[model samples]
Target: MSEKKNQKEKLWGGRFKGEAASILERIGESISFDRKLYKEDLEGSRAHAKMLHKIGILSREELQKILNGLNTIESEIDSGEFVFRSELEDIHMHVEARLTELEGEVGKKLHTGRSRNDQVAQDVRLYIRNRILEVLDRLDSLRESLYLQAERNIDTIIPGYTHLQVAQPVRASHFLLAYFWMFTRDRDFFQFAASTNDELVLGSGAMAGVNYSNDREFLASELGVPRISPNSMDAVSGRDHLLQFLFAGTQCMIHASRLCEDLILYSSQEFGLVRLPDGLTTGSSIMPQKKNPDIAELIRGKAARTIGNLNHMAVLLKGLPLTYNRDLQEDKLALFDCVETLLISLEGLEEMIRELEFRPSRGERSLKEGFATATDLADFLVGEKGVPFRTAHELVGRLVSECGEKGETLFTISEQARSAISPFFTGKEYDRAVSLELSADKKNSFGGTAKARQIEQLKIASESLKTSSRTKE
Candidate 1:
């Protein structure tokens, strides 16, 4: 070969007669970010090499040498000894080049029935599969923390809100478990994402089935994946699994943001319904008395980035033509960011929840002051006194209006003033109607805020964590 041909072969194989421009090399390189896939890439290569050997494309000696070379490369990357080059373009090329350097021509045989397209697709699927388990584990940790908090505060009452105004009284445990269940659904979403990524895409070649009769079943078994891609073109081109992973992260972050919002609001002096642990909070730079929930706030802020990441993946795949395109290179930017953001957020939120302190007195005081027992009064009149619900609602509305005008609460209203509202509004019944503890306990229906229901929920939540642990096993 001529020197130019040799140089071209060095860069990419002998497919080109002219040199690639520096700008094209720079712009085309994904080594900086896609290097995150080195482990996955190396694993896929090892599996493909074994498959090639099974099909008689490689001698046993060649297969052993390639596996040894791959193991060494993995160690180099793990120990930060690997040097990634832009000229190599991506993790797939980097691993191949290093293997070729270590094993000579035998390393070149590793790609016998594989293409960068299918290789990259397989790497991403493996990456997503591993990450989904991690996300689920973190989610389980957060849920466990919530369960413990709920167990500790099963009888502690707090004002529940609709439109951000106190609407009713509920046990503090019920409030915490609301988030527990949201995270539970987030866990389900991640598991579904994992299932979607469980297929092996190797042996699909570039965009069609390879010429060799490679044993994809053996490849799948070696890689620990359960299924093989049914269509070669779809195997190389599909990114639905990646999109699902991003969507799952986006949903988990949204739930984290909501939990943060509640903690931020409740930890404020005006609400004072809860206090975040001092270790989880930060001191203000200028103010001596400020303990800021900076971690929660940051987690809340990062939720937007996850949302943007999901949107990025969705839009990136929307207009691409099938079988593989350079546009797919951008997919990892969102995928990796969402994974990091979500894991960190889950860890931070779990730490915060584990140490959270609920101020039951403050919560009860707020519930009393906000007329959170109004619905309980309405229910008492309808159930005990046989009063029509609309009449009871109107009567309670008037009583609340009067209390507001006179700066008197239901507990402070006089017998005469109470009876004047209605014949059913005697002081004794009014007293029973407005007891915050009784108000919360009276909601004894299934999934209600009563203490018994909370106990039942805590049992269910514990079982859920155990079930998840078994599933993981």
Candidate 2:
């Protein structure tokens, strides 16, 4: 029997008879970062201890003492009174140190059929599972905010853009619902990440099946894991669940960055289409009349770092042949960093959007400069003048260019000038071409730019938010 002073004297201390180099220890240590996993590690240890007792590996009285001692330590940690020692190496040893302090000989029995490798795999999964749920809740809140805004703006017309140039008219609600759908896909990605965390990795015994006749199913159930990992080696070594979550985080950040870009561009003096509230904007240091959209810009820039984190994880896992390796420790910092970045970005964006005020008159003026209603003219020519769509399209193009040459709008062009471009042109055709009402109303197809379709989409988005909130609860 070997009894050691601490973790440095126990498992994994090969090759060093003296203390480790300060730099080496700091690089190898995960406690400062992984202390966040203390709760999950304790939950896993409690489940393993209960299973050990059920299999007659420990006496009933010993099980009671271990369980009771574990509960006390949990309370102390939550109250912030527990002291952590870097000498313990990690949470597993730190918790075991406390258990041994309370239960003496019985605390030694808790390690009968486990290894730190599988234990750490369990802890990371539990942490990611919980964090993904938290992100999903935030996403649902943002979805609801957009849904409410859509409901209010359904009738407001705005210029649709292609290559940052006004292309046509769109309901403001329709543009908002685009984000609603983006968030819906984000929710689905989170659901996939959570589902991948459904298995138990305990009882895997480092890298092989343990010799003990352990009840893995019982251990899995006690840990709230849906099923035991089928292969002990894979269970101890695998990190696909973390990768799945990183990928999902990348998707979310990408969507947020795009939205941030649009908001920043729209709020610029050149666009003059939107005004970000004071809370979300900042003033230039030397300029007296500058209100910069700094928050939106930061959100957009941080997304690149988040995406880089995901790529780092992928490249790290790509070539490793494993049971367990020190390389896996990098997963914690990467994941924690990415999730924290995402949450802050989401919070700032939600606030920015809530305070967003669109300038409809400015938007309408921009829409007019593009001869944006020409598509409506083309459609009318096809329907009423019995002209082929291609001909109507060509004729509309000619009318648009002629208006440009005359330095006038489509409405301001003379009747003779319009007729010179196309015999299909008439008073009714000219009126329909500039009618914003007809442009928006004629687009009533499901999922179109029409106000009615946008309203229906808003109702659907609202229902989605309510259902997702209840699911998270």
Best by lDDT: 1
Residue 322, candidate 2: Cα error in Å is 2.8
Which regions of candidate 2 deviate over 4 angstroms? 1-19, 411-428
lDDT of 2 by residue, 1-473 (tens): 33224325644566557655555555667788888898889888889988989999978899999999889889988999888876666888878888888889788778788888888999888888788877987887788778777777777788889998888888888888899899899899889988997788988988988889999989878978887799988997788888888888899889999998888888888888788888878898899899999998998999998899888898888887867888888878888899899889888888887779888887787777778899989988888888899999999999889888888777678889988887767677568766876798788988888777776777778778878878877
- TM-scores of the models, in the given order? 0.95, 0.92
**Candidate 1 local lDDT, 1-473, one digit each (tens):** 32222336453557766665667777888999998888888888888888888889999999999999999999999999989877788888888889899999988888887888888999999999888888888999999999999999998999999999998999999999999999999999888888888998888899988898889889999999998899999999899999888888888899999999999999999999999888999997799999999999999999999999999998998998887998999999999999899999999999999998999889978887899988888988999989999999999999999889988888787778878898777756778888998888888999999888889989999999999999999
Q: Which ten residues in a row have the lowest lDDT in candidate 2?
A: 1-10
lDDT of each: 0.89, 0.84
Q: Name the weakest run of 10 consecutive residues (lDDT summed) in model 1.
A: 1-10
TM-score, structure 1 vs. true: 0.95
The TM-score of predicted model 2 comes to 0.92
